[model samples]
Target: MKASALWPMIIILTLIITACSNNDEASEEVDEEDLEETTEITAFMPEHDEMNFEENSFTKLMEDEYNIDFEFETTSWDGTAANERRQISLASGDYPDVYYLIPWVDQFSPSDLIRYGKQGVLLPLNDLIEEHAPNLQAVLDEDEEFRAMATAPDGNIYGVPQLVECFHCTWGNKMWLNTSWLDELDLETPETHEEFKETLMAFRDEDPNGNGEQDEIPLSGSTMTQKESIIPFLMNGFIYDDLETRLLIEDGKVDFAANKEEWRDGLEYIRSLYDEGLIDPGAFTQNADAYMQLGNEEPNILGAAPAVHIQLFTDNDNQYDFDALAPLEGPNAAYSSYTHPIEQGATFALTNKASSAAQIKSIQVLDYMFTEEGSLRAFFGEEGEGWKKPEEGDVAINEDVEPIYVDIPEGEDETLRNDNWAASAQYYHPVEFRDGIVQVEDIYTEEGFERRLQEATYLYEDQEPEDVFPYWGVWYGEDVQDEIAELETNILDNVDQSAVRFITGDLSLEDDWDDYIAGLESLGVERYVEINQDAYDKYLENVE
Candidate 1:
């Protein structure tokens, strides 16, 4: 080979090595810039005591996977204080980039969603749903009921909702009889309303509590929420009592259930129990704490109590003694109080303070929550540590899906195991999703909590009337919202007050019934119905 050729090859090798070194340095510089470019999102949410937000596994996952850090402006779980703080933030224009709310605690009401959305304080999610949230969009598309509830009257989705379709929550007015009392007294479970009345009489007069004194109250409940109210369960035997709405749909028209002839009969029956000292006086006026105290009292003086679930009423060891009574048959009607399965409460809302990048990432974060893996992780926590795949002998609600998971030992502390962000995540555990999960048969311990509820609620299934007024998903327009709200508040307050009076003998059912009806009429109930019916018609148009 020639000397010139060798020299050329050596020069080319040197040039190649130099070029490779420069390329490596450039790549290192780009990596440094990439590391520095992460976006931080600010969020406001109610903080749980068990949650260490900085150390939250879900937050860590999000930061690592998405190159985003969430800085939360939080309030304690106190409902009134949290709400006041949230409102003050809004008024002061110092709110965070996003609001992650617990629907049952301090989330935006549908009316508030509409109001804030229209005022430009809350951003419309239509564009974000179209661009970044395929998971959330899929949910809304598949479930029109959910879509209808989440959407505002002006046809914008102002907030993303917590879509928990807890099957047991659908018929939440079930009465749990102290079957231990029945077993001790040698009484059979009542099948008819009359039989139920006789059993209550026995509980009152016969001293079923074994205390040797007449301390047992035949029936008791609390007025904390309609779910705790006993009237729905007892009155339901006579007429369909839509517990919250107090309205029922028949022949495409909405009518007040409290003023109907069947309602009068139901009230009369409850009055008879009150007159005979069968019903607890505290049941009408007491709060949950007071009611719980009565139930937890020594000697087990309560014969029966109404609640959405026995767990809602008590977590004491005595919760095991109560067994759910099936819907009793009445002469005119036999139905259980039915609530809409879809939870429409807003759990995630984007504020106008969010930057465009923040907006995109916030929606992305929530969209992740709607996925199957995300839902399970947010709800139950990391698999294996918090939950585990079912064994061969384990029973799942649905047998088709693979790798159905059950709660592990750590997941038993349901109140403490999961992170705080899980409570604020937007996700819906629909029937299909919940059905595919594993459920154990044990109800006594915290390990198989869901199993106990599923079994107890089974008795109330298929007992709902076919024509239940779908008031839950209906949205009144801005024009009629105030009028409807004012009217509803007045009417519901009066109805509750009057019911207590009639049940406690402060008012006569036969004489004061017409006046009670007249008072409700005076509260602009006719206009209220008209507004709700219109909203219902509109919702049907959109959903159907």
Candidate 2:
């Protein structure tokens, strides 16, 4: 566990790579299955400015195990720019052997996989997986939903999946109050919708800071992310739980949730708040860096903003202070938390041109990432030496590599070091299983976590809308995908532009609610529902 000992392990691994290629057992015992000479696998990826892939433990271990070297082609995470670049690459026909961590853009994402698979650009992975990847097959058989999602229109498996077991990862839309401001006025944390409004109003008018200046801006955030967006998810308490960008399966339809009557109700409440000067005027216009500046100033000026957690608003320390408030209980006496699936993004894919060994082995590599042993090694580095498994019930931190870069100020660069050679890798394990090794105590105090538990505990009772119509919850075929995509886009866009208009009082809910519902109808909500029903029916039939 000391720094000096890691060098020996590195030396041994390098020797294995040089002498026997990847695996010692395969080197000695295997001849008929030996891969032909010089199998070059090239990988395409988004930019990892700080990561040095050559020195990564995961890479080092895999290369030694499989004797396969990877060449990576990468880009920064700009979707429009990446898509344009990809089109050029496709046109040029100079593609890499693999694509890793490609994001989901409207035109470029789902369609790309289908298009590429048909063009013979991607290999069918199911039979290869059955032959070469027992671990992956275990996950596929165990989670039929995941298997269903992994298959394409032609019923071929073309890509690997990204899976994580972080239950708390679906960040609830939470309101964080500055306890300092509340104490100055001697107010309890607001519990219900009415109290929340009054509290923001008090922050705006009372000039809670006796400094005789009305500089306090109540309710602020940027367009950075959905949970952090100023107007969308937070407004769910007042309305039909319509979030401006919330995507969900509702009534067996792939329609955007924002077009519902609940959205209009939510917008009306926001309009009222803005009219009373309770919501910050700058929130809509401000950039994230500017917004964060207001949050992190020596004396923070923010009051009652919507955020995922207090950490996003301020640091762990109470210096730039903020506090958690439970999700508001609305007029309907309803409180709910919305979420997508547990998994977040795609990690990688193999090509049709690659050897069968490469295709199956890629899945095997990914499968390892999902295991406690493999995920820990993939993210945290080697187990017995690189990281010390924390004692039961005790969450610990690697003094070597902290998750956040305290090494730099906000907006500065984050440097990643190689765990195989240096100290540790930044990622590891299913987060819940990270209990003994990663502490919530340092991040959230026992008191604060307990309070959060109390808040979301009651709110978790509301099940997902997709779950009620369970059949609509899985993957759709080619025709259904096209119909759903068109309907979802129109529905979301119409609601977003209108909801913002309604909240700014540029449009009125009283006058426009009927028109909005009609517009959603015109955009094809019914057909959207039917596509979902058909897909769900097929998925159910397959299972039965």
Give the top-scoring candidate (lDDT).
1
Which residue window of length 10 is worst by lDDT in model 2? 401-410
lDDT of 1 by residue, 71-128 (tens): 9788888989889998777655566778888877788888878877776677789888
- Model 2: per-residue lDDT, tens digit, 1-544? 8878886566445433432322232123323355433345676665555667666767778777766676767665677776676655554456565665633431224455665665556556777678667767887787676666566657777665554433333445556677788988888888776787888888877777666778888788766555666664455565434232353455544444566556566777778888887777666666667766767755456787666555565553542356556566665434344543333223456654455555545555566565666655665556554455554454233323333211111233634545432211221233344322443444346333533433433344352333333422255666566777877678766766676677777877888788878887898766766676676666665554
TM-score of 1: 0.89
- List residue ranges in candidate 1 displaced over 4 A: 1-36, 397-403, 409-420, 436-439, 444-446
Evaluate model 2: give its TM-score.
Answer: 0.77
Residue pairs in collision within model 1: none
Which residue segments of model 2 deviate by more than 4 Å?
1-32, 35-38, 76-87, 102-108, 238-260, 315-320, 341-345, 383-386, 396-415, 420-431, 434-437, 440-476, 480-483, 535-544
